[model samples]
Target: MLTKFSITRSCALRKFTFLFLLLSGQILKAQSPAADGKSSFTAKLINIEAATTEVFRYNTTLHNGDAKSKVVELKADLPIGWMISFKADGSQVTSVAMDAGKTQDISIEINASATADPSKYKIPVKAVSGSDTLALNLEAVVKGSYGLTLTTPTGRLSEELTAGSHLDIQLVVKNTGTLPLKDIDLSSQLPSNWEASFEPSKISSLEPGKSQELKARLKVPDKTIAGDYAATFTANNPNGNAPAVFRIIVKTSLLSGWIGILVILLSVGLVYYLIRKYGRR
Candidate 1:
């Protein structure tokens, strides 16, 4: 009777322990997030700041918590004129395959319009697998871009001028970027003894996509050699600089040409007179 009771007690203890373990496992499963049969989309950084001309990159992950594998399709809602793409394993992809309780690493590339204004934009990205959809919100802060372009109104870079005279050139200064340009100073690199001046030597401010007209007075010194010379005109600011090279062709004045003709005629007349007088003697 004692041996039988001991054996029965041992079996009862084992049964109670097994029941307790089974109950504990059920409770733990209920508490686990993955056990809920839900998916997740997460990113270490959801907000980024960059210039309008630069590309925005975000590193993210997609997690599958379901009991089966899934083909997750990725998508993003972006503003018009903006572009977005996804990459997995260094290759461009729109969907990824994930096994149960597995995770996938992805990269999101976004490009805002080059002319986009400086502002904060919201981008909503989603991962969908059948009836399950996981969403993530991303923010992009676009900064201003500074750029300048200096050229003539007619797009001609060459000019002709007479020596010892001044020429008035119309210069068009354009703000080629998305931001305003301020305190832009005008300057030039010319040959020695040459003079250059702008009507408005300094620009207070120029708006994006807008142009300002300025008069550039270029003076060539008297007696300058007749040849093609290079003149570089620059519009400079703290942010950027635009330099334009112009070809200048110098020619003697019409009065000087007439004087040369007279001199040549006089020399010919004198030589003819000398030859006749000396030959007769």
Candidate 2:
């Protein structure tokens, strides 16, 4: 009951089945080598440390177990608001070819934003060559930022001054950051013939969220004009410096006020005398 057409169809079916099995076996063999190759390598994380806004570098070692070199691509899973860079053998690179049965060194640099949170972070890193993948975990401990703020007790940035007199003002220096600030030197910038000084001269250490009261002594020159002047108070630490501007309003002295009153009175008296003489004529 088998015709020529049936015989041809049977042969076609047999050829198609043989071709499909051969292709499938070849794909499985190719993919299996990569999965097996991953077991021949290891990734190690070393020298991972804490950092602030500044950049921090870490090292990664790739140890090859097979008897051949590998061309691997490097990648990282960094947190939001953070950046990372990679280097190999002291040169900037995104990948490297490791030698057979030897190790390669990679440098990783991580940078966080200024407003990033101060806490511990675990970033994931990976190296891949084809389907062979090696994973690593990097631990980063973030150090808090260093900052300080200077202001007056009453929050007023201006004060009145009398010529030839002494003025006393209180200022509050607060640690407005996460780290403890030490050796904060206080200084002032004033106009000519004016003097200013801080009570303690410098701060030993200002803890986080803590404030200290400081007395500022100011003396105005006798020949100063009755006008506005600008004064600057600066707080400097090892990290950086902060500046606060204070407006100074100089007023006339008591003697000057009395002299002006006497001059006005004499002018009024002369005018009254002149009017009386003219009316009599």
Candidate 3:
């Protein structure tokens, strides 16, 4: 039979061997990267604050922590009708090749359609290299797109005009947009040597769904031919601009019109008198 001291010694030896192997395995795992020259990677995403229907920019920074250079591909899943692109050094790119432990700054341009409504949108960003993938989330705040519309109070797009006289026109300027409009400048397109002015050259402020009246005085040239002509009135604001057209019908002056009527009557009376005097002769 085995003695008690021998038995204890055997058990101690077995425990020592097990502990030594465990420590050896830990050391190997810690040094495996340096020994095998394997590469590691890291990716990061940045957030976007806000954007408009107009072209806006966001930025992202990526770092490569591996010992080897890699071509990292980037992509984004955005809302419908939305677009995203990446740029580095002012040139567009779909992916970036970076050296180990190096960082790159990329320009992320995001744009929405003009018809896009005001809301918050979440964008999913991805970076991939081989089997490694990094997922990130971003938010885009879309502000309202403002617009201005200039028209007649009755919504008539045409108006009457005369030469050598001042014609008064009334217009309705409305803020037909999602945001308030301010400092709207009024202007007009007219024939040469003609003059046009508005009562309020610039509006102070116009809220959405609000309308204001503007009186325009147009001075037609004396020599303007009597025919159809087109004139445009525009209201321009920082948000957008609206244009209105008017059809000018240059009518004959009162004096000329009366004279024409008198001539026609005289000619008819003369004809009647000649017929009566020579009918029997």
Best by TM-score: 1
Worst ten in a row by lDDT for model 2: 34-43
Q: How far is candidate 2 from the true structure (C-alpha RMSD, Å)?
A: 12.6
TM-score of each: 0.76, 0.54, 0.53
Worst 10 residues of 3 by lDDT: 34-43
Across residues 1-281, which tens digit of lDDT does each residue of candidate 3 receive?
A: 99999999999999999999999999987654332233332224344444354665666677676777789898889878888888988989999897766667777788875556678777777778888776667777777768788989788777666668888899999876657899999999987788999998899999866899989998988778788888899999877899998887887777767988999999999999999999779
Which residue pairs overlap in candidate 2's backbone?
none
lDDT of 1 by residue, 1-281 (tens): 57988999999999999999999999986665352466689998999999988999999998898888889999999998999999999999999998877778999999998888999999999998898889999999999798899999999999999999999999999998999899999999999999999989999999999999999999999999899999999999999999999999999899999999999999999999999999787
Candidate maximizing lDDT = 1
| Global CA lDDT computed for model 2 | 0.82
Q: What value of lDDT does candidate 1 attain over all alpha carbons?
A: 0.93
Q: What is the lDDT of candidate 3?
A: 0.79
- Model 2 Cα shift for residue 185 (angstroms): 2.3
User: lDDT ranking from best to worst?
Assistant: 1, 2, 3
lDDT of 2 by residue, 1-281 (tens): 99999999999999999999999999987654422233332335543555465777776677665556778888889888888888877898888786655567777888875556678788888888888888887777777788788999889999998999989989899987778899999999999989998998999999877999999999999989999999999888988888889999999999998988999999999999999889788
Clashing residue pairs for model 3: none
lDDT (CA) for every model shown?
0.93, 0.82, 0.79
Model 2, residue 56: displacement in angstroms? 5.6
